[model samples]
Target: MSFKSIVRELKEMRDGIGSTSRRGGSGSRHWHSRTKSHIVPDVTLAPLEHVQQGQWANLPFDLLVDIIRRVEESETTWPARAVVVSCASVCKSWRAVTKEIVKTPEQCGRLTFPISLKQPGPRDSPFQCFIRRNRETSTYLLYFGLVPSENETDKLLLAAKKIRRATGTDFIISLVADDFSRSSNTYIGKLRSNFLGTKFTVYDSQPPHGAGMQLNSRSSRRFHSKQVSPRVPAGNYVVSTIAYELNVLRTRGPRRMQCTMNSIPISAIQEGGSAPTPTSFPQIIDKHFSPSPAAKGKGLISDLNHATLSEVPVQSEGSLEGLVLKNKAPRWHEQLQCWCLNFKGRVTVASVKNFQLVAAVDPSHNVSPAEQEKVILQFGKIGKDIFTMDYRYPLSAFQAFALCLSSFDTKPACE
Candidate 1:
């Protein structure tokens, strides 16, 4: 059916909800109308038989479930998938049901809600996505698909604006394009770098482990400036850190890099293992609160440095910790006289920003060859202002995107 038809059904379902509330006794569940555009009456304003656009109707629970399930199953991809979002937007009851019916990215491998950006990708394969850069605005926009044309409508997954700093650089990531302020609801997280641009940290506005984890005072003071609604968290939780090693000798080679996923455990790299996934959007408790790039054309590089961006709280190491990712080394092509890693045709351009990531080897654990060679994440340039990003389990789109953004920063010491 057409999207309009689904919306019509949803409207009917919403109206049905109100009808049942009035006819049924006091024990019946009541759903509060939250949106300003829609209003729920305190008293019975009209007879049960009469209905209005804003009035609620009682849709059978089974029917409501079936309809929403169909919509969720039918529209699996974007633009078309917006129908599912529309269903959630209909009303409180609708939203609850839609959320229940929709599965997390780890289970379904589909991004139906905004929260999917922070959830781990499918364990079996990587989710293919692309990035579009706007040089004029110094903004980087991430889209859900490999959208080849600039004019075509792209499914925006996330947006990051590069803000340069005296000591280093910062990229404020958000759900909205223009707004980067941490106080705003659109603020999701950010990437911060050191003076030399050799080391970087990925910060999440909400706790990655869940609601129970609290941000330390130092992390809170570093970001929060204004009071925020209780629905969105205001603290900065470090999810991961990206560090490029400094080459003091000025060696001419591809950059070597490492990613320490603080939120994920080393056991996650093992077969049949899983990673932590956030269930809902973080809410900011009023009490809890709280860069541009230069290198235009360079290859991936890696090295180590002692200097850190700042002294942030380091979670005590547990038996489950130590999930480090190192850049997959590229083999030198004899004919081309350059290093190369098989992107499997996902990447077209040969920019220095291209690199693939895999779990770092640990002598303590015995990981299989398949898991060892699996590319957890890979990003490469396809064109000017366009790049391909593919990521799999243990890393969400947000983490993958933030790591890719690091490639855009000028790392003179590493290169």
Candidate 2:
């Protein structure tokens, strides 16, 4: 039937049909009559005009469950979450839909994944609870990536042990291998040999290198160290041989292991207190390690070194500091935030309850507030291209990210 009809029916079901009485109206009481009844005493039956726009959570549990069920099974899934998240902000019913989406299995999934019932639920909090719970109970994939460094081999081994202990089983851990693979193996093997009782399987991840990973380790007993000369054999291990970092794996499963190779610049390494944390990294092309000749081009470089521009130049709104901080990635884009991750493959519709978000643009529109919203609304309708449209909501990645020449072309400059 028509949505209006459905709403009308729902309202009647919520209140009652044909019941009427004198009720408040304008500045005084007024009497109304239903087709099946008369009213002159106390109150009147008046359906809320905005009932259709009401919170889905306020709907009967059975209907809310159905709404959430449809949402979860869709490939673009809802996070097993709660409704009162910011995505609910526009209205009361929108908030209800958000909650219904959370409590439904289509969203919560086969795992009744325990939430820390003590804490207040957060808006767009992310999959932290899911990751933590799976580690404790699920046989999911893991990558034991560690930058090669002074104590990296040992550190990686320790991390594996921790994962194993948390999951209560020794999981097959993998590492990267290349020309340095043999040498790296020797270092890693030394660390693994130190573990006791924890059984682990080792697969030499060479030849068919750069393999996709599964989450579980084979029975530890399957790991047979080869006899090198009689007593010593090739150490059992798995390592990656890829160029990109894919901490890249399914939200679940064993084959999803990835790590960033050690990439500390020589400049930082030799500079001692200057370099960040990693201990080992293959040499990279950069202005220092490998500069492009001026003959090549004024702006061109030999390699994809760090960005030439050094800082974010935009002046942040002081009151907006909290908003930007709340909405932004950390200083170095340290770890991509929840809003930045695109909420997986969820679909985009102009639906009231969408938690699926597009990138938040840094507002740079040097325009009147009306003009800014006009631009923002225009882009908001398309669901992406925030800064290119307006910077108020889609902000700079911090002023530091806005200074580069490439960033100069942004449409509405915030200032």
Candidate 3:
């Protein structure tokens, strides 16, 4: 039957039913006793035709792998492992693809641990390491995948410990290392932060057995017999220095921590240099609260007013060497009523224990308002006692690594 004819017949049947109902009901009380019935459609829908789907599912497996590879190689792959793990959960095929491209520990950059920290696994185990804080001693512990089996667990087996002293803005840390026997400890070097955490000085402590001292002498034997070693030499044994430049500053709020690390000069540490005296913590706090004397005088006020009208330098983006990094220095925030560093750019959030050291053409610049600044190093937190560093071309791996260790100046949770 045609659709139009079927529809007309249904409409007529509905009209007849309505009329019959009206006729059955009419007399007074009987009008209210009429019965009604519901009508439902009895039509069936036709099945849909099959069509082609998107080609994404049919993409070559190698092509998908190439896409992932590019992402892994990017500079912003800080949380790369987490991103890859997420991709694995997308589908069975993606999971298989990601597994093949996963980076092993040897392939990835090194994971550093704070001094005195212990790892929590079998000594001979492989890539991952766990780090935790020791609340009682206010110290950090590091654990690695593989440690020598003969190394005693009870004693602190530390290659180096970079500590942020309880009191200074200076990144000064006490370092101790195992003696030649690998059984006892010795004071090896002192890493001191300079130029407001922009540079560092490493001083080698004098050996306990000084030259010309008779080892078999009674005095020497008595000195060596003590459980704890004698105090380290306070003289000049400066070995190297590290300088850093602050490149980018990413700040969203006043509460978030602002930090970074960059490159060091080969010449800065070639011969020993004098360590800069650290400014006291109390002095830093007082300076933040104190108002400028220029605000108090009429003449100084006019000078300051003139200075405010001057144009400020705009940061330009370019190669790492050409980029200027300014140290805006900490300023008072009226809204926050707290001291804050003016990074002077869109603040990018950085993770803990991650840092980079970039070499710049000019490592030094005047701190005047008109001068363009350059960053020598950039560093940030990656994890507890862990950070990443990228130094300029001149620094050796050992020098860069030493400077990188000096960047951890913040107090850990245990403290």
Candidate 4:
């Protein structure tokens, strides 16, 4: 009748059943005996209810702001920007919070070109210049649009037409891969631009020895003599060392590109010594191009103010340094499982077709958090055969473009 009385009767019924089960000869009880004796107790307990949901939106504003700041500062991967954007889209409350957090340019990551680049069409919006890579071939076509047009496609097409007609060169730079796989891993390729193509090679001279057997007289003899030994081909050697070289193809002779990785500490290695220490940070260097003989003594001396017309000193090999590369330290990316560079936060995973070229800073010195916030150059994907480069510096557009192109190589991480 009463709540307490009914509860006592249910407990007494349960205890009686337990006592009978324990005294039985067999350990196992029948289905009828196991059945709960109390189907519905006379007592009416409180009805079940749902627990109240958490009030995440009601969290202190300052605490929320701190949480977002930590996330923005720590997330340095490729999808970091996407994660921030996602937070903004969660709800109006979150959106307002994120908006305040990203007000500073440094707080917001650099602009990205998510889509692969495509050739500019007549009606497409105009860009300063366009770098097009052929999908079917390993050729990169550089278009320097001298004529500025409202339409980006028209500008690129016009520039290509004018340069081709004047120089009789298509401005096509073909990348010929040495390896059969044609992947960026290791290859010797010719970067044919204008009429003369430059030869550049990226190869792993000292590959890891663990992956394959070294092809030597001793190993060959051991394999041949042992009937059970598996034959390993000479070509099955792994590359352990990596080197890059560029050669300028000239009419008279092929001159090695006069360049050096500046600011890199030179460590002397003894003959037949251990491997040379690997560079920690990427190096930036100036490339000097020897003046063409034909251009010598051709300048008019009359115009004192005309710097272009004045004869440049013979000793002064024009610095192609503006177009020179500013190499960032290649980092091991765990997600992409590749070696990449964060060029002022513009590029995460470096590729030949996609990379950023920022101003060269001392590698030994760490960049101040405030100074290293913005992007220097944003180059790479917009759509297929179409690429974008948003350069803020005063470097020559061609040189900047070329420097970005140089990054599309096989680095250690790629191997």
Candidates 1 and 4 compared: the better one by lDDT is 1
Candidate 3 local lDDT, 1-415, one digit each (tens)? 4534533443454344335435653431121121111001000001111101222234478876875565445422222223333333333455456545643322344221111111111111222222333344433333332221244332122234444444333322222221212111122234566434555565433211111211334334433432322221222233344444443353422222222212222222222311111111111111222112221111111111111111111111111212222222445679967554322221233433333322222434322322222333333333443332332222222233444455454432211
Ranking by TM-score: 1, 4, 3, 2
lDDT, residue 161, model 4: 13
Question: Tens digits of per-residue lDDT for model 1 on 1-415?
Answer: 6645766776566456545554554333222211111111111122222333233335567877988899889888876776677566554466668889999888998987777888889988789999999999999989888655566656778889999999999999977575576655457789999999999999887666532333456544533434323333244667789889888676757899999888787767776666778776533221111100111111111111101122343341233465889999999999999889899999888888899999897666777878888999999988888999999998998999999999999988877
The alpha-carbon root-mean-square deviation between model 1 and the true structure, to one decimal in Å, is: 11.4
Which residues of candidate 3, in runs, are more than 4 Å off?
1-185, 194-199, 206-236, 242-349, 361-398, 410-415
- Candidate 2 residues 74-177, lDDT tens each? 42321222112222322345434543454422123211111111011221122211100123432221111111124422111111212224322233221211
TM-score of each: 0.78, 0.15, 0.27, 0.27
RMSD of 4: 31.5
Error of 1 at 96 (Å): 1.1
Per-candidate clashes, comma-separated: 25, 46, 41, 19
Highest lDDT scorer? 1
Residue 159 of model 3: what lDDT?
A: 34
lDDT of each: 0.70, 0.22, 0.30, 0.30
Higher lDDT: candidate 2 or 4? Answer: 4
Alpha carbon deviation, residue 107, candidate 4 (Å): 26
